[model samples]
Every structure is written in C-alpha cells, then in structure tokens.
Target: MSVTHEQIMLTSFDEASARRALALAGEALEIEADAIRKLHARLGRDDSVPRAVALMLACRGRVVVSGMGKSGHIARKIAATLASTGTPALFLHPAEAAHGDLGMVTAQDVLVAISYSGESSELAVVLPAVKRMGVPVIAMTGKPASRLAQVADVHLDVSVDKEACPLNLAPTTSTTVTLALGDALAVALLELRGFKPDDFARSHPGGALGRRLLTHVRDVMRSGAAVPQVAPDALLTDALLEISHKGMGMTAIVDADGRPVGVFTDGDLRRLIEKGQHFGQLRIRDVMHLEPRRIHPDRLAVDAVAVMEEFRINQMLVTGDDGKLVGALHIHDLTRAKVI
Candidate 1:
C-alpha cells in the first residue's frame, strides 16, 4: 500500500473523543466566567473602592505585592499590571522579605499581601517588619477575619464558593477571581489619576501597543527629500519624476499655497495611459484624485492604520489642521512598526 500526502493529512478524530474535549473546555470557560461575576459582585461592599484607591494614591514609595505559591504567581501578574498602568508597583516574595528583603519596604510604601488561606507561614514572618516600618498593608484572602487580614489596614475578601477543579485541590476559580479583582483595582486607580493612553504607551515602548499609541505620524512618515510631491499645475511627466525619485508609488499634488489638493498614483497613470492621454500635456490636477484620504500628525498611528484599511488605500497624507502638508505614511510603514 502506498501512502500519499492527502492520506497523511486526512487523519480524523472519533466523534465521542472530539465531543468530550470540546465539552470539557466549554465547562472550564463557564466556571471561569462565573468566578469573575461573583468577584465583581463584592466591589461595592466596605467601600473597597475608596479605601483601595486611597491606599495606592497615598503611597510615596512603590506598591509592594507579595503572596505564597499559586497565589504568589497571581500576585506577580497583578503587580506587573499595576506598574504598567501608571501605578508604581513591584512583587516581593514573602519568604525573601522575611530574611533581609524587608529593607525594601519603607514608611511611604504600601504592601499588598495575597494568600487564599490567609495563614501562609512566609507571610506571617514578614508581617511584623511591614508594620514596624509604618507601611500600610492590604490583605487579599479568603478569610476576612484571618490573622493577616485582622492586622492589615485593608482586607480584600477573594473568597470563592469552590475551585473549578473536579478534585477540589487545585487553585482554579479562586486564583482567577483574585487576579480579576487586582485588575479592577488597578484600572480604578488609572481612572482616578486620569491616566491617558499616551501615558500607557510611555511605559510599554517596545511592542505593538507602544507602536500603536506612542508613534506619531511624523515618526513613520516620508519627509524631507523622500516626500513625493508636485505642484498641482505641474505636468503629469513632472509628477511621474517626483514619484520615481521618492519611490512611494504616488505623488501629492499641492496647490499654489502648498496645501494638498489631490493625489496622483500609479493606478491613475495606468488609467490615463490606457485612455491615450499624453503625460507631456496633462497637468497633475487633471488626473489626480481630488479628495484623497488625510490624517493629522498628532493622531495615533493605529488611527492612521484604521483609515488606510477602511479606504483600501496604500498611503495617507499627514496634514496639520492649518492645511499644511506635514508628511506621508504607507500601509507598509504601519506593518513594519507592528501597528497592524
């Protein structure tokens, strides 16, 4: 028997096996969603919003977040989210803090302690030092009246009805709820401080989000000697030479005052040539698209990418509100910048 590429590629799953996998995945999603809903329900109690917000705002030093085991993992993520969203925060391992890391905590800092049981030994060892320094502590735990919670300034109750794990041993729904609550607190602080998207971009200056928000049209646009520009009254032959010199596949047709009047592209030239029109006698104004898409230099690059996609255009003319041409950007510019 000969095995072909098609035969090798056509392997199939039995119906029962496929259904079981899909059903389990859907059940897990439902469990996680329920956990989030229940957690959100707890936000209004004890004026948690005002207290948590005040705690973060009053801290002169960085917010220190700590936890043990699985809860520790969630704590680290929460700390990262807080740091990126305008609030200064860092994660400190509870065990490490007990040994000499307590030196990192200062009178001006805020300590956020995380433990599902609220009785982690490592957390217990570090509690006295955190208090001695006059640092305020916020505890996240299943038990509000537990030792860690009783001693802390604010206690956040992350109690879940049960874990999603069938064995009831793994930290599933509880961990997710705790993480969600942390995000809620961070975002609330972001709103209170009037944190803008540009502020967020400043902290994350290396990825897609950074490129999308931090990048200005002036940064990625073809400017100076690279801009394909021609006066509106110039002959089509002159516009073609500008396009060739810039290699941007199009030339901006500007009025006598230097404001963009129209755009002439390779597409326009092909159509004109097919109509037997002579480039030598035609003016750029006669063959250019009268209303080409345009964007402002101060606007986000993501917005520029959106406009390009909506109009199916390759390039957009960057302009100032004063109607002065500033620069030009191609769809490829956005792609290379990862704004796509």
Candidate 2:
C-alpha cells in the first residue's frame, strides 16, 4: 500500500501529540518537585510546624482533621496516615460540621483545619463554634493573614509560588505541598510517641508486613514427628529417607538426648556424591554440618527468614533453651506464610 500525503501528515501529528504529552508530564513533575523543595526549606524557618506537632502530641483525644474541597480530600488521607502511625485521628468534613457534625469535636480533640486560601466559607462557619467548645485549631493555609489563620491557635504555611496547573487556578502544587506537610506532621508525631515497628504491625495485621512482624516461628514450624530428624549415628541413607518422608529437603542429626548436634541436607548429599562417598555406609555424623542455624519457637518467623537468607540455607531447626530440637521450618513455609 502506498501512503498518501494526508496519511503522512496524520502520522506526524500523532507522534507530535505523544511528545507533547510526555513533555507536559515532565513539566508537571518539575513544578511539583520545586514546590516540595520550597516546603522543605521553609520547615526550619516555620516555628508553627513544631508547635503544631507538639499540640497534637499533647492532645488527650483524637486529631480531628477538617477541610473543604480538594483540601478536604488531602485531610482525609492525613487522618488515615496519622491513625496508622500511632496518633489517633479521624477526618471531619467542614461542610457537615455546620449541620451538626461539629458534635464530633470535643475539647480534648485537636482540630487540624486545611484551606489553601485560609478562608474556606464552610470552615469559617464552624471554626468559631469549635473554638467556643475549647478545641484548639491548627490551620494549614497559604494565606497567613487570612481569617482562618488569624483565628487558629497555630498556622502551618503551605504556600506554593505557583500551581502545577497551566492555568495556575486548579490546586496541584499547593495540594501536593499540603499532603506532604500533613505527612511530616504525622511522622513527627509518630517519632514523638516512640511508635515501634511491632506496634505498627499490630495496627496493620492484615498486611504482609504484619505477618512478617507478628507471626512467630512456632506458628509456621513443623513440630512433633513431622520434623525431619535422624540419629547422628544413623546411616546417610536413613537420613535421606527421613528427609524424603518429611518433605523438608533436610534432616536434623540429633544426639541420644534429642539435642541437635548437626544438620544433614540435600546439599550434603550432593557434596558426598561429588566426593564418591558411599551413602549406604556413611554415617550422618561424618558428613553433617555442625553449629547449624537454629531459632527459638518464640522468635519472629521473619527472623527465621533472615537466618536462612544469611546462610543461604533452605531450612532451620527450632530448638528449646535446652538445645533440644522442638520443631523445624523450611523456606517454603516462610513463602506460604508471606513472611519472606
């Protein structure tokens, strides 16, 4: 088929269109990045940022985040982050506050009000009432001199030089800055409260991270006779049989007291084969790896994974304080539990 002049022009226009779209995306990223950088620079100069965090930390009740329009959307996310990071928080819609949702705010709660202009009409109608109820307000806004900022106990300046939008009307850079500032506040409060990973894991128990932190070795380990084991004096062939029957790719070489003296794995079989050793006659004690990696039943399953990864092994034995083998675990167990 021969291409017509019109077809050639259409293809050129399509290519130009793609290039323009990519250019616009890059410009938007640059604008947002610059806004964040400005926000970062302003952090040290703004005393209110620390004071706001301190207020939230001292709050006896939840942090109630309230805003309007795009700011409201950001406020909801901020509340979620705060709640998840150890600070009790919830989002309250300013528009709903005037219609009696203001009852959600209590004197014990700290109010975080967000408005780029610092003069959202919905917020204006409710702030005085919230203040009257003795709820301290922390205002996040671009206009420091605006009514919302003036009335607030604390003001967080989230001003951007310009919006990422071409028209400079739609909230893009400003909203980004506001979201980042909210995250900063939440993280600061998290540090102040000494929120540990274990505590965070408890709050996020449904996630893979929670499984890693909360699941104990005993929870996923094979206990009792299911744990592959062989006497140290047992023939290599017998150990191999135990490994095969248990399907753990390894067997613990235990003493008469049932204490793990060494481990015999598939890798040991490979090494013995390469050395032309007779598996039928060789004792497990002769070829087993001593000082095998082991973990206590109470240790985190994730810690078991760390040991396996560090030694490049697939299985580890679980031992009691007396060094007696109580259980065993394989890499597949961690994979199944999503601890890896």
Q: By TM-score, who's the top model here?
A: 2
Off by over 4 Å in 1: 1-45, 231-235, 253-262, 280-296, 303-312, 319-326
lDDT of 1 by residue, 153-178 (tens): 88898988778886778999889989
Worst 10-residue lDDT window, candidate 2: 275-284
Candidate 2 residue pairs that clash:
none
The worst-scoring run of ten residues by lDDT in candidate 1 lies at 6-15
lDDT of 2 by residue, 1-340 (tens): 9999999978877977989989999999999999999989988995898899989999999999999999999999999999999999999998888998888888999999999999899999998898888999999999999999999999999999999899999999999999999999998999989999999999999898799889999999999989999998898888899999999999998999999999988888898789888666878898999999999999999899888888899999999999899999999998998887
What is the Cα-based lDDT of residue 323 in candidate 2? Answer: 87
TM-score of each: 0.80, 0.85
Give the alpha-carbon lDDT of every model.
0.87, 0.93
Q: Which residue runs does candidate 2 get wrong by more than 4 Å?
A: 1-15, 44-46, 233-237, 273-287
Q: How good is model 1 by TM-score?
A: 0.80
Model 1: clashing residue pairs? none
